[model samples]
Target: MAAFTTGEAVALDLPIARVPTRATAFILDLVVQIGLALVLGLIATLMIALMGADSAWIDVAVTTVIVGTLVGYPVVCETLMRGRTVGKLVLGLRVVRTDGGPIDFRHALTRGLTGAIVDFWMLGGFGAIAVITSMCSPNARRVGDVLAGTVVIYGQKQLPAPALAVPPPWLANWVVQLDLSGIPEDLALAMRQYETRFRTLTPAAQVGLGQSLVITVCTRLGVAPPGNFPAMQIIGAVIAERQRRALTPPYSNPELLGLTPAALAAVRG
Candidate 1:
């Protein structure tokens, strides 16, 4: 799996295209480009024959066709298709930046120029340099991809959603009654982190951290910690209570909502 980490520190698991698949795509693209060149050359020849064009014009047209077929084709396709050429689309592959963002025109241009100069055309037109580079690189990136800051990946896979901790059934009513708004942002963040990863911790570590967090939260809320309640339950309840309060509308009179003045004042204060 190729993990693309964003600036936000979120890691995404995406499949990287292997050498065999990439080579196949490249072969297909090469065949298409060759066909395009043949057609363009034929058209240019016919135009020259009909117009009685000079030798200089013929040389210029041949150079243009060769350069355009080798370099301009990939650049145009990648830019218009947003990193997807015909071959890439056929193989369910896409070129993207290391951060998993879409590649831009400059990236496409660099890749195309580098690929033509060193990877394919320069190395006996056998793509020997590209193959060796991809084999040697950790992520199977060729010289073009390295120079362009891009990578090829299987673009169709979806990332799974993270499972969040929920409040325990026994503490549901108790949590709704408490003034959760008094909890500090840092403490709340700690509770959330603990709740999310408590199951992964060892028994001793879980107990130690959960107890510390429960004590801290209870102190911040100006309430006595319940000894019988599970630590995970307490943490989940606090998280749920905060979310609930955020979604709940404020009442005009606390007494009407069965909340004491002190309870309401705790949140306001």
Candidate 2:
């Protein structure tokens, strides 16, 4: 099973698409692309003939159309379709980030541009470099995947999400102001685990671990403890706030308020 860890520190076991499957998908996509190019070429040829254009111009237009179609097809499909091309949709494969997030235009553009070179253009369009690279890489990453920081995986949904911690209504305003960047990933994971299973812990055990976690996180965020709030509440608030920040894009309408992001989220919450 391939373990795909998300940016939120959640790990999912997904099937990695192997070379054979990838090759099949690519061949399917190639056939469609070639068909599109041919149709476009036919149209161009008809137009050129009707206009009595020179042979040199016709040659240039055909070459330009084929090249543009080859490159633009993947870019448009992957970007607009969220990594699913006609071939990938048929094969149930999708290109995602290494972290399992949805890829944007930049990733699609990089993959398409590089794929045209290492995967198709060089060595008589045999994809020798891509095949060798896929064989060598554990994730079957070709030149485009490597450069774009993406992986092609089985596109079906994985395991259900875990229950997340909720911030208390009262402390939401105060907790949002903390700088959470210093909190380590493992520590954050531990906090999530603690939040999920806290009900099972004995009262004494809960107090001890909860206090310790609150102290550690508070120290990391460079904030003093809220006197009246429970330790678990503090921990939960930070985790929830961090999650909200992740979902909130920078320079969004939330920023229009004079309030900081954490504070704005607190207000929204």
Best by TM-score: 2
Q: After superposition, how far is residue 7 of candidate 1 from its true place, in Å?
A: 4.8
In model 2, the Cα lDDT at residue 19 comes to: 89
lDDT tens digits, residue span 1-269, model 2: 47876544466887888889988998999999988888888888888989899989888887778677877899999998878899998999988888676777899999998888777665426787788889899898898999999999988763333334579998899887778779985688678767767899999979999999998888888888987677788888988887667546662433111233344445556
lDDT of 1: 0.77
TM-score per candidate:
0.58, 0.65
Cα deviation of 78 in candidate 2 (Å)? 1.1
List candidate 1 segments past 4 Å from native. 158-269
Compared with the true structure, all predictions reach lDDT values of 0.77, 0.78
| Tens digits of lDDT, candidate 1, 95-142 | 887766567799999999999898888662679889899999888899
